[model samples]
Target: MRQALRQLAGRVWWYPHDEDPDNIQGGVAVISDPAGSVVVDAGNSPSTARRIQAAIEAAGLPAARRLIYTHHHWDHVWGACAWPEVEIIGHRAGARILEVEAQRSWSHHYLRAEVEANPRLGPSFRGRAWAMPSWEGFTVVPPHTEFDDDLTLPGGVEVRHVGGQHAEDSTVVAVPDAGVLLLGDCFYSPPLHLRQAGDGYAADLVDRLMSEYPEGRYDWFVDSHSPPRSRQSLRDLIVSG
Candidate 1:
């Protein structure tokens, strides 16, 4: 599927997630400035990454100089290798997780064996992997730079480690100048494939996120798998539910 980049703010552009036959790709955000573009998350595979790259080029945006991961999930970080020249950044814990993943073999047979060994493994992910046409060039690329709590890159892009129920390494990217927040799945419930208990949201984490970057702080909130919503809308969804 050819995904088109949609502008969320003056300097921010994102494409929605694509559910292809082989891979269920996550949404990707691009923050462009005179310096260069900073991609929020790499997609599901190299092909997905290329689609993102193509969209950026088509839009005449600056080439991505850096790639920032929201977490260590396969759908979010597997495309890191595709942007070899871009510096990859992520939370320290996420980097560690990716490091371990990088050591494992990702062949289709190996993945199938893993799924067989652990039924709790993501069934949706497993099914998609089984449908993939090829696993060629598929490898986990650990972040080159790791930060603990928060880091602000050039052009006022702020990255914060706001670990949540979905993943402990969950992070949020904010463009203060643009009034846009790139929430890479941090607000989502725990993976349904895990059959996790409870409501699937860490109330404390949600409170922390709101306390830090509260409503009215950002005009647009972009989740990895959902369409952009107003800050108040997201706050209501997470806070009231």
Candidate 2:
């Protein structure tokens, strides 16, 4: 439940939940322009999404005009329902994955039961502070826009289907004007094996960026589960992975 928000670059903000082993929440990024704002990866649930929404308002930005999902993971897509009015965008594969998840009612129930069974989740998830989002009547709000490769938003924010070791539908969003990149759990934290896309593709993306920006064009690289990482830090991860 503990979340913190900070500015990473001009008109770009980072909101990350403090690292908690038992109950993890996805981090998010907000990119704003006079036209509107884009929210990258809504958090894990309604409560977390509400906090993100509040943070955006507090930062004096407009309500999110669009939401970009990096993949189809429940932690990333489930919160789309919270901002139904905003246009949701994601990889075509991710959109299909979300439809499948919407039908997996049993999976949602199982997750809740698992959290309740684990004592480590007591304070944050099982206790009074927070609870697993009720799945009874749960439904997904699928992404309205899907792309095969890459798409650019109004403010030079680019979302590319840069598949990675994380998932086949993984996306990498870049706000070039702000020198910020958001890599949703793709090449960041690893079991390395979880990546459905080969490591080579992931490496290629990093290599291209590195070559294109010798002096570090991107100041911050964000993952859904962690804080903003430096350009070199992300490069190190890509190399090591």
Candidate 3:
């Protein structure tokens, strides 16, 4: 956990779901520049939302301006209920996750209480669940603002919708001047543990984003898991792919 925190600069932060280790991961980022800072993804609990809010405040950014839903997974969007004022953003494919998969994942967990009771769901995340993001009883809101491709995104910073990787709505939010590109789970490091997301991941999305990220041009690369990578390494992953 400390290593993950160290990976992100002071400007970004995250909150973990104290459940089975592999259960859910919460990530949120802040970019307090011109276009304005934005929260990349909401976590599982209101405390997580509050932590993200605290991180944003610590970074000296606004309380609420933009909220980005990398994907509509339960852990990613469930906590947004904590901040109803923020404008949510995501790709159309992600919108479907809200409308469809969000509940499915929850039902899978809720209905599988026996599976969870049997053995903590797995050896890795095995433990008494503390605060897993439960959509079991909450409102699921669709992305208020949806873009297909190449959007004039906001975050107190200007970002371009680079290309698709995670899902059809997957977009690489790039702050050109900062050279900081938020690769929304495009390259899931083993550290960013999860089963899978609709048959996407590994080198597929990572390779695509790297190919389009101006090639050996970015100054910083941020993902939910792998911390930040220098331009050389960022391009190398793509080049190697």
- Scored by CA lDDT, what does every candidate get? 0.83, 0.73, 0.57
Residues 1-241, model 2: lDDT tens digits? 6555678898788888557655666788888877778999877776677789988888788789999998887677666777867889999998888888777543445556756787554433332123344654346767899999999988788998877666789898888878777878765433332323443435776676556544557677777776677877877877676
Model 3, range 97-213, lDDT digits (tens) per residue? 787744544433543564567543443232113344353445567788887765665433444454443444545666665556776665543222344444323666655556666
Q: Which predicted model would earn the best lDDT?
A: 1
| Candidate with the greatest TM-score versus the true structure | 1
Stretches of candidate 2 exceeding 4 Å from the true structure = 106-108, 112-133, 188-205, 212-214, 236-241
Candidate 3 lDDT (Cα, whole model)? 0.57
Clashes of 1: 0
Q: What ranking of all candidate models by lDDT puts the best one first?
A: 1, 2, 3
Worst 10 residues of 3 by lDDT: 1-10
- Candidate that beats the other on lDDT, 1 or 2, i.e. the better one: 1
TM-score of each: 0.91, 0.81, 0.68
Considering only N, C-alpha and C atoms within 3 Å, which residue pairs clash in candidate 3?
20-125, 21-125, 35-156, 35-157, 36-155, 36-156, 36-157, 37-155, 37-156
List runs of model 3 lying over 4 Å from the truth.
1-20, 33-36, 101-130, 133-137, 154-166, 189-205, 215-217, 235-241
How well does model 1 score by local distance difference test?
Answer: 0.83
The RMSD of every model to the true structure, in order and in angstroms, is: 2.2, 4.9, 5.6
lDDT of each residue in 104-219, candidate 1, tens digit only: 87777776787788767757657447435687776789999999999999888999988877889999999988888788888678876654556655556655666776666668
